[model samples]
Target: MTSVLPRTKVSDVLFSCCQLLDISVKWTIQYDSPPKYPHYDPGTSRQLLCDQCPPGSYVKQHCTATSPTQCAPCPDQYYAEEWNSNDECQYCSAVCKELQYVKQECTSTQNRVCECVEGRYLELEFCLKHTECPPGFGVAQPGTPESDAVCKKCPEGFFSNETSSKAACLKHTNCSALGFKIALKGNAVRDNVCQENTDTTPQKCGIDVTLCEEALFRFAVPTQLTPNWLNILADSLPGTKVSTENIERIKQRHSSQEQTFQLLKLWKQQNKEQDMVKKIIQDIDLCENSVLKHIGHPNLTFEHLNTLMASLPGKKVGKEDIERTMKLCQPTEQVLKLLNLWRIKNGDQDTIKGLMYGLKHLKTYHFPKRTIQSLKKVIKFLHRFTMYRLYQKLFLEMIGNQVKSVKVRCV
Candidate 1:
């Protein structure tokens, strides 16, 4: 009887049950498919937003639909210091000071730092005073915020009087030039103290008057005295007439002796005697021209003298050299006066000969700066004088030309 049910009825019944199960699952529990489009927002306009702001900058405003993040620079004397989302810059920790200048200027990333200027120094918390270079010392290096004033001892023959930075040690005074003697010799710290001469009479004559008189007198007389006449003049007579005759004869003999002496002097001068050489030299001028001739560069300038001096053992000469040269040249009337005096005092014949030889050579001699300056002044004066003469000549020539032109036109 179980097997007897119709085949059609069994198949239909199985199919209808399966369809009902599928419908129930679909209605009770749903399954979703993939989305149709990507997700987006109106504020960002599909663009990616930025991260936090970096240091030295601040966020001014948030992003909108059409714009990215907006930022602002930190103000002066303020800083952001780090990457921050802050709306405003932070104030600087270090304040500006009236006594100091800016060591490091303020920036968005760095703070301000201050320090002292020149002529000032820094104390513990602030800038204090500056130290000065004292007397007898000079400034080696200027003061700064990091270092105190540097000073050095004065050099030899130099001195400084007061505290200073700009001044150097000055050369000591030359007492000999002003007719004064050095009371105390100069040192590094002190100047040469001087004292005046109390005596009024001239210590020495500018020229040897005896040499000049002898040279002149020798040329004036003419005759020689006989030996017999000299004997008669030496002996005394007994009678008045004989005494008178003897007196007359002695006078005549003396006159003849004077004449002979004068003739002998002339002959010695002609022969160029050693004793008369100084007098002969005196007759010559010893100015710049003669000096140049002696140095063997009569056409050259003062520069030649400098070149010659440099050839000596010591290149640069001192004040003593200048003084010596001045003594030799200043007494225009007496050419060998200084040389003769020097020979008498030192009696160094070899040295005198060497000096004379050097003077005759073509060489330059170094002089003191003061002496050089004086020479430059003289040169300048000469230049001005030459220019004046040239101008006068040119003006006269122009006048002559004009006169000639006018005369020709009239003719």
Candidate 2:
């Protein structure tokens, strides 16, 4: 310090002195400055990186150097599924409609989910009732919350007797395995009807003769004695031959009812098996149109006939009958005819009672309650009208007066 030394010589002297003191010194040489933050700062015109908000939460304030980001959870009926810097959460928008219910409730991090109620499925953003498989068809697949039911035709050896949305086709009952004989064979729409083996003689195994006579009197007519009908009868009885000429001669000689009775009797005698009753019924069923046209009612319509047909026991109707009804162009005439055939086959029971039972059966599965109720009203009106006429006749008889006709108006 006393003598003024050169700058280099003074630096060397200071270094030597630091080494002699036994203290360590380090030097950090920076080549370039650190990179700036990507985010922008408005107040200072500088770049900064702020912390992000987490899921189910929204940022209330951005982070600064001194404090972290401020975040808040989504409120009720609001959701935030991802990390965001938004100030508010999204509102839950899903709303369940008729026949629908909430499958999953709305949460802070998720939206609500909807599904159809029981017996319904979702379609076109709406809920609809599940489809029911009609007779002769079976449920191939069950319905779900998002899809409709699937149906398939019943295969051979299987049967579906009623309309259903969930039941599958069932296997036909094996009468042989159950130690019973098959009274009626099973088809696609009906199960096997089993009966105990009681008869030993095949010739005597037949339905009641009185029943057969009654059925022939009610159902058979002279018009049914055509060449085609005679041929069908001949075909049904392989052992017997039906002569068209003989039938024509018989028809010409006797009255209509007597002709029918004699023709049936001849067919019964020729058939040694004597299953003439069943055979007669089967042949008459082939001429359904003729039978139906012969019997008519002014008050009944095709719709009423259709309901009654639909409600008949599945075994009572054949596949051909169903197919024929479906293809009819003149529904009014055909339906009236069909009702008469139905009456004959059902032993000529009370039409009103049969209609009521049919309506009740259909109301459970197919028709609406209001429609069934309306039909019931019309049936009741018919019943009351008939009863009124009978009572009026009885009153005239009791008073020794001539029966007078009275007009009734139904509204």
Candidate 3:
């Protein structure tokens, strides 16, 4: 349908023809070539109408262009940008609609697939996975992160320890320490931690608490016992007491009878007062651990003397058990000898009162958790009589040089 015209050029034949001269004229014809194919514009896309879609994109429209390779994709996600000749648009970021979770990110042209939020699984036909099943009751395991785990009842004595745990609590341990039993256990009872024993009693006397507490309540008063030094231990002696009234009086006497009345009275008071009991325990923890240096007195510690006085009343400690444990402290002989000399010549008072206050360092840990049924007997006796310094002398002689030697350590 397109064409170019031919052009001709004329020579000087005009004069010859007019005069009847025989000069010939020459005619030349010129033909034009069709227009050249258009060169690609510098800014034009380098795409071909028949080209296949590039990676990350699919063909949306077939090419009207010379080459078909030029194709665009829908943007990723939701906020995708528009493109030319795009088949599936580029992806854009979209706030996931109602039921879908963000599964993938959107590109400049297309939107991503959104997954169903948890509790609902995806369906393969509509989505990728299946819908979540309903939470089953007694027949099922407890719920878990990965859908539902099997549910179960808490074992006896055991309750749930964690909200997320899927297992039922384990069964509680069968036996407990004497005088106590497990009331309720923490978490799954299946584990050993199902429940701790409540009671901590022995066949006779409270477990050598005067000796044992050192290991138990070591945190607050390290290397030291609870306050009341030795007296705090009276809690384990069942009926031991150290009433304010009788405490001083008993500090004056060493007899068995006097020791009973006062301790009984102190026990009557402290036993009924839960707060007082806790506070007393706390106070024992507050005592100072002054270095064992006697300013004008002896360098030896009289801890055994206090131990001996509390050991009396016979309500709790037998002579053998009391003696053996006290004798185990370090610098045994040196401490006893120093205590003996100090007791004899100090202010002419021959009582364990000063000695009791001096050894107050190791007092708090004397009692176990639940040994005291009624501490009035020992405590009442302790209040009624004063400890004569001679008791220290007597104790030193009784244990005498037989005391074992131990190394010096903080606790």
Candidate 4:
């Protein structure tokens, strides 16, 4: 019979050989087949399935139990540019032109936004330079990063001669208040030029002694004098004074009884002559009024007057107080009437007739009883020596409203 061999497992074969080689033995089992998963050295081998994507590429798919990580290059205008675990590339930030700046910064998922820089404006996708308002035009609205500037033609008596971004139209120059003659009148694009006055040196009656003596007699004699009227006349004359020496001189001139009677006769005649002179004066005042009216009284608008009333340099009329008064008196004919009254009461009218000249220009149809009473107070203010300097100051402010911008003239 053939020798029968007992079936033995592979593990037992090693143990059986070990037992034959030694009297007593201990065994440690080891496998020679490869491991279930592949192995690699981190320092020398290729990247494994779990490794991150390298620079300039992003992961297209995640690593799975059976597959390695899948990757793709960054598309145009997008970038990874570094080793990352991100699922997508970053979008490029905005590259603005010289006239623009970044309005919103870029993010990994969002694109950058841009805007026009200061002194420049935007137009569609690109930024364009702003155009300044030219001569004869004024700024209607200022420019911004998202919108272009708006301009309008200057109104009558307003002017502009240079390019500017947001400048308002300048007013024409006033020659009368500056004690200068108008060398050249202004228009919508140019300012008036002034020249020195070549008229009489003595501001009162052109250096005539007779007129000076007449003015003294009209203003000083206690029997003929009304204090309010006399004071206003003194202020208007520019150089005449109320003094004891002048009174003595007048007294000496009329020392004789015959001369006194002759002085009385002359006074009476002059009074009649003054009435006749008033008519001529009224016509002259009308001519002056017409000059301003024809020019649309460019400085007399509500806006111009409001600015002047609120920005004068000194304490003649309180600018803040007047502005408050203006607000209180708005939405009625009283507003325009008050403005005209302010003009009249603060003006140095040479005669009472001249003081009343502003009345015709006022609209009295809707005036309240309070307005009429207020007008009386205005008339009272007109006839005071204390208000003389104030009147002159207000007059200068009036001229300023009608005058060109100081910046343009200085330039």
**Which candidate ranks first by TM-score, i.e. highest?**
2
Please give, for residues 76-185, the per-residue lDDT of candidate 2 as tens digits: 68887665667788898758788888888887667888889999998998888889999999999999988899999999988887898998887775555433478899
* Per-residue C-alpha lDDT of model 3 across residues 190-299, encoded as one tens digit per residue: 22221222232221211112211221122112133223422432333332344343343344443332233234324433353455444433432232111112111222
- List pairs with backbone clashes in candidate 2: 292-337
Angstrom error at residue 206, model 3: 10
- The per-prediction CA RMSD against the true structure, in angstroms, equals 36.8, 27.4, 27.8, 29.7
RMSD of 1: 36.8
Off by over 4 Å in 2: 1-55, 64-67, 82-85, 199-411
Predictions ranked by TM-score, top down? 2, 1, 4, 3
lDDT comparison, 1 vs 2, better candidate: 2
Each model's TM-score?
0.28, 0.37, 0.26, 0.27
Error of 1 at 323 (Å): 20
| Model 2 backbone overlap count | 1
Candidate 4 wrongly placed segments (more than 4 Å): 1-92, 107-111, 200-411
Best by lDDT: 2
**Model 2: how large is the Cα RMSD against the reference?**
27.4
Count clashing residue pairs per candidate.
Answer: 8, 1, 110, 0
What tens-digit string does per-residue lDDT give for candidate 1 at 1-411? 466658998887665445434433443354342112222436556744443344566667655556545556666567766655577878776765668888888877677767886677777766766666788987777777766677788888777676885455666755554344677897866777655433531213232222222223222222333544323322311111222332332343334534333223223333333443343334322233333223222232334343433322312443354345444443331223333333323321222232334343432444344433443343343334443344334323423432222211000
